[model samples]
Target: MATAASRSGRRRGGGDDEDDRTAAMRRLRVLSLHLQDPSPSSEAGLAPAACAAAGRRRATGGADAAAALAAYLRGRHRDTQARVFEFFLSRPDLQTPVEMSTAAHRELCFRQLCALVREAGVRPLSLMANDPAEYFAVMEAAGGADISLGVKLGVQYSLWGGSIINLGTKKHRDRFFDRIDNLDYPGCFAMTELHHGSNVQALQTTATFDPVTDEFIINTPNDGAIKWWIGNAALHGKFATVFARLILPLQGKGGDPADMGIHAFIVPIRDLDTNAVLPGIEINDCGHKIGLNGVDNGALRFRSVRIPRDNLLNRFGDVSRDGKYTSSLPTINKRFAATLGELVGGRVGIAYSSVGILKVSVTIAVRYALLRQQFGPPKKPEISVLDYQSHQHKLMPMLASSYAFHFATRYLVDKYSEMKKTNDEDIMADVHVLSSGLKAYITSYTAKSISVCRESCGGHGYAAVNRFGALRNDHDIFQTFEGDNTVLLQQVAGDLLKQYQEKFKGGTLSATWNYLRDSMGTYLSQPNPVTSRWEGEDHLRDPNFQLDAFRYRTSRLLHSVAARLQKHSKTLGGFGAWNRCLNHLLTLAESHIESVILAKFIEAVKRCPDEKTRELLKLVCDLYALDRIWKDIGTYRNVDYVAPNKAKAIHKLADYLSYQVRLVAQELVDAFDLPDLIIRAPIGMQSEAYAQYTQHVGF
Candidate 1:
């Protein structure tokens, strides 16, 4: 279908020059592919561009489409305008007052964020949109209010399982629902201990059931057992969903919660009126953290804190007045999974935020590269820095990434929604693993991508005026909170290998299975038809036109390496027995990341409506796929055999691709749904001229 770009002749905002031509070429390739076959997805099975457009159409027709359209169009225009005015808004000319205050900058950013939050809140997609308690009364009334209100509160418990409900019996939900919406109370979820992070089995805070008084005594055994690093608990929160071991007089469980395991209780952290610690409660602020300063993090310790025995958050496990411990879920792992499953929402939130940050980064890099003049211009003075081959190599792939992550986030969001529906314990376990794994990967990618955006912006990127510095700080903690990346990655790897090993038969057929899956069509593989077609001969031995080329060869070569790993795994018994097979596991995870990215990049190119946008995105995707394949030529190849000449040629192409993308950076950023104020960078807006900034900043 001919994508009917608007009559303005500016379907995408930018210049008309050599850079435009380059971007156009890239787009034509993608558009041609889409024209050939207009299926929902590609050879490797990712959704095609048509699907995106179609989705957008359905989105507009949704029940609240009018409201969503308003939000989308406003955000879209806001972002585009922000990039256009990057120069003046950069604050380069704004003189620093003698007193030196930053009220203007702070207010500018806050207002921007507030607008963005409001924009997202009003979107048609219920999951994507925040269900504000004030706006959606039923959501609040049904106890689902926490889903959106929790995000709105920006509370310290970013992990997602927090409830305003006093940790009483499941019966408490009845009373808590009405009062919670009324703001009669506030709360936090305190599960992690100072000693162990991932290992929840080791918490030491103890809750002793006193059958005599019907009041449970919750006490921290030592300083280590104290609940440290609680967020809203520092100020806003009136109570906490505290995790401590349960001790019963009848049962022989020791004072150590480990014997009874961790049980959650509603413990009052502060006297709401005075903001003072309730009796026997000691609280302090965690001061500052690496990121997410909007939330007030805190430290809390309990010394014989007393609460009614009914104060147990008994959704999972419960205690009766008789000091009996009972749980709806039988297995301890299931209960544990339920406890941690609360983080799933957090993972979803981070995933959404990560996409936003990536889009912002791409916009800044592309716009700056386009307008910031450097090197030569035809007869008319210096050219835009985007003309530089080196520049394109840096920014284009990341541009491709912004698109890819958007799609991946869509798939991930759907998966999380499904996870929420199933009451099955087994399904919940899988959800936990999937959510944790994807969150780790997505957050890690966002962190890395944001840095690349910074570096792409050059010296300007390093400045807070560019917004990357701040966004980088915001994204930095994603790796640690929820779950540490390394730890989470290991867990993901473990889960992957576990699944793979379960099907491991006596035959070492990993290689055979992979090869046949492609040739015989048993793989049920994705739409990456080319990657599926590998020769029996090793890829390193071939030197055809495609092999000679870096990007094409990168995907092909990795496929071969992946084939080899599959063979290794099939032969290596269980993953546990394969002590020396860590490398294979690592590559397996990495290969999937490459596959998803490749699919998205190709899909974006195929489906993008604009001729220029499609062309620019194709090159970005190609460059990205190649960058991954050869990033570590040392470990990838047995010898440094890639001729320096061939390497330079590939780099040249990557540079060319980057240049094409840089021209359209402003347009791409605009599509990301950011408001101009939130971007808060001089080069972030669309309409500003470079000269204005250079003159103002004395550049």
Candidate 2:
């Protein structure tokens, strides 16, 4: 065994070698010089004067640029966000408490939600129907204030009320819309059963038509049929948009009823006046969850609950008093698809709200990084943690991702709005696929990124008051609700394969899938040698190059997965092949979503009217694209699409861009326009973070 000094020397490639020691000391001296000034001196490997001039040129336009970028990021709903955020700021009671019991948190969340509706006058239904842009903006603002409050509001308006608005006819809407808007009818969306969550088509709950009584008898056939994880069901919800298999009574006696497939029905779960559980409904608390204790998740079971015939949300399918079921969709599968399609707004809302979470988390982490300083060169002031390359690598890319997701989710919201306005089947289909993909992709990303943010903040982050714990716990369920990320990814994969097959039939592809048509020939071919080897900063920064690389990866994955499935079907059967290729299918779906996000980010950057803001966004876009490319360089290398030298260049460029982004990281996070009131973390304060944090921790 060697002594400690000898071991360290060996680790540095020179055990007891004087020459090596000298070289190492020289290198340290140069590094110290660079760290001391960081203005590109000769020791820092650049001409000081010229680089200093360039640095001045590249300096941020300060608050103006941040405000302009914030405007762009807010899209068409800036006024809504400003108003809502101001309202939240004014209401100190709405601030999330540092400590509370589950019941207390739930009650507080509910009261805050009521205040948003009654005091703030946020008419979610009206906004959704007339101004979806403002609707999402309000949701995003609510989420930024408190994740639980945002989710509870979403369950009330987007899921429960939206089901009535989109799936129900005028009668249903008239009965529920005003009540829901005014909080007179707090409701639950009772869709997910204990045993069959993602597989909605296989739900075991039944709603039998009683023609004689002119009512539908809803029942939970087994424990597995109990509606699980239902928001507001534990206490407040008076009604639910219950989804169950519609069973039509047979014409003759002693005959089995006809199962008319799944349909939505308005079922009363509790007494509105007294807030008591209805006669045939049983509600049980889900107990403590990892996060989001404020949402009051509960299990609901219906035992032969009876409701009038008109309770059925029959926009797509309806049953007559004589027990005749009719639908314009013709088939059970078609009707099921259409009915679920109407609820796509839930997924869109999840995606939008997930971005809100990302913004808040990133804002906290980046702000903390900017404020907290650690080691520095001898005889000099300590440097911010954000100045270190390693720190920048950790937080800057994620910051860029938060920005990327903002525009991506915004695009999803606009597309959803367009689908609603046009009601075109093709647009609806596009929205469905897009919403599912974004919901899964963005939520999962935010969930993981929140943890990174927590760790990036160091020991103080572990403090409950810092909010990482709650943010992580509350956001964890986003990946499972709306739809499980795995199931949703498979859905996206299935849609991609459908598009691939349709492309072969010379069908006109939707805007989202049109790239598949070109992928067959253009993307499947080997890369040109020149393009493969090109590794200049300008080339790597080009949006076209970034998008092309993304498209290539997605297309290649799509093609390979399609071929593999085709080949495996002969031996394994269709379902077996799909199971065997499940991992690959998920990869394909993720790649496709990444491509779409990059395209949207590029489009958003182009649409920026402010020159300074556009420049900043372009830099952010480059960081996002290059960072993703570097992470997936293996895929490009495997396909020979990127040469070895190019890969190395990409790695270097990504690091450099991370540093570049770190320079304006504060401005980027400030562009989120989050008030200190909403952030609520002493460590993430805008000024005097150390003082605030010490005071907060009782130092």
Candidate 3:
């Protein structure tokens, strides 16, 4: 029988003597190198010097600075994230995709995720707490490793669990929160209908209050009313928090049931004990999707399901024993906002997770670039692809964005933490608007970055073992689900317009809304080529200048779109006019979001504890800001925001910044602190990747 050492040697392509000789040669070579050195320096004495030299070469302040930046970027949840990564690595069952023919693998993955949640003592209602940062950190880490698992957890804790915490009263929380947290009662969030996804107000599903039985009868009146894209509904969910139009009949003044608008209710979906589908709840699997197959998304329908009146998540709207509808808020729209506001947590969580995934993509691509060398001058050693201008162009801006979004997410999480502590109307509106816009912007950017990372790694990135396929496929849904990116941007545009109108009417503005005031003064004045012309690189680097340019661009877009909208509305009414200006509306929303990210990024960089970290990150900030400006150069150029020469300079500066960023590309990606276990991609292992490849498969 072959010995263990011999088997290992055989796998690595060797024999016993060859391995021994090779080991002896390695030791001899090290000894020779030390003997050959003329310096009297000890190994420990020389280590710091070597690190410092490398840091200088990388242009990242030094090793200490790089280390500080890494720590800051890894965040406060590193210990928890490390443990999660280790736990995932230990379980082979969790590492690979299961075949679609049998959902048993998906079920296994779900069970593992549930086990992790149970151990964490975290539930969806946890988001209601002022500090759910730890839980969100874990979710973001998990998402970076496995998108399906992260999304499943989000469905359980943020979507389904959060709805109960936000929309339901104490009675509902008492009945369900603990069980849901413990996985004793699995649930799904049912909101999107077959015909209406983004437009919840137009949903056809209804819950009619029956005075006779004192129950709310839930019904999917038509096929279009089927609740679609519901996670865990096919097999796992025991109940769902169903959003439907509330119908309460008046005693005398009634032609049809009084429309009480959209409301949420907890309806049983399956038998908790038998794990069987319940009566009146029809469910069918949505089958294969572009990604996240581990999550059993399904379409659901209710056929006159009678749930008790108390089933309503009535924190905002409630029905008395006599079937009279009453609400704490005066209007239905206010109630809808209050109830659906629970989704803000999910949106924020997605933004964090999106940054996390982008970090992984950047990490893999950067590491692979460093290890995989290509053509060089004749009779010279091959150079790293990362040294190529085009390669740097492909990745460094994305690298900068990964950092920008990282800081932006931290700021958002902190700001949201404060907002949850108060009931201030203005702050809440700001939070809602920011969360929607950031979610749309960050997810879309991450998706594009993932694509770039995949292409950067060439053919290896396309392989499942390399992890980019999974990254691209799983995250594709994020741009559509939580809130469709386009639809969410519209919300941002509407909120901005409201603030713009308020400021024009001389209403007071909060700090975040101060830009709207600035907008009225700046964009409303007129176009001036000389005034808007771009200055030099020094001027571009000025934070105040960047802020002004961003604010001006956003304001100009808003002003232009609103003006066009007014013209269309005069002839076509509000909805039709809005439709006509949809493209401009999207641009307006995106520009506002970009400006907010830049502001937060600058603020975070300023607060860096280490001078070196701050200096290095400032360059990253420049790259992020300038790259965004470059993308919108046409807009700026068209509006005379910059001279033609300045436009040319902007393009040149972007290339130069990309080259500067390339010097520290590895260090920047390393700041994310993703472990090899989570990264999984062999190419991501760098030099060892090739060795491991050669060892396993003969070259």
Cα deviation of 692 in candidate 3 (Å)?
3.3
Q: Candidate 3 clashing pairs? A: 124-157
After superposing candidate 2 on the true structure, give the runs of residues whose Cα lies further than 4 Å from its correct spot: 1-18, 26-60, 251-254
TM-score of each: 0.67, 0.94, 0.88
Q: Return the top candidate by TM-score.
A: 2
Each prediction's Cα RMSD? 14.2, 4.0, 13.2
Candidates 2 and 3 compared: the better one by lDDT is 2
lDDT of 3 by residue, 124-214 (tens): 3454454567778878867765677788888888888888777888998898888877778778999999999988888889999999999
lDDT of each: 0.52, 0.86, 0.79
Runs off by more than 4 Å, candidate 3 = 1-63, 97-102, 119-130, 525-535, 694-699
Candidate whose lDDT is highest: 2
In model 2, state the lDDT of residue 259.
Answer: 85
> What tens digits encode model 2's per-residue C-alpha lDDT throughout 1-699?
899997786767644476778889999987875564343234224332112211112234777777788887766787888888889889888777889999889989998899999998989888998878789888888888888988999999999999989999999887889999888999999999999999999999999999889999999999999999999888889899999999987843478788878899999888777887889888999999898888988999988899999999999899888888888888989999999988999899889888888888888898888777777777656777776667788898999999899888888888888888889889999999989999999999999999999999999899888889988998999999999999999999999999888888977888887876666687667898899999887899999899989988989898899999999999999999999999999999999999999999999999999888899999999999999999999999998999999998888878777877877787888889888877888888777777887887688
Model 1: runs farther than 4 Å from truth?
A: 1-170, 178-184, 253-258, 377-380, 424-430, 505-587, 597-620, 632-656, 689-699
Candidate numbers, best TM-score first, in rank order: 2, 3, 1
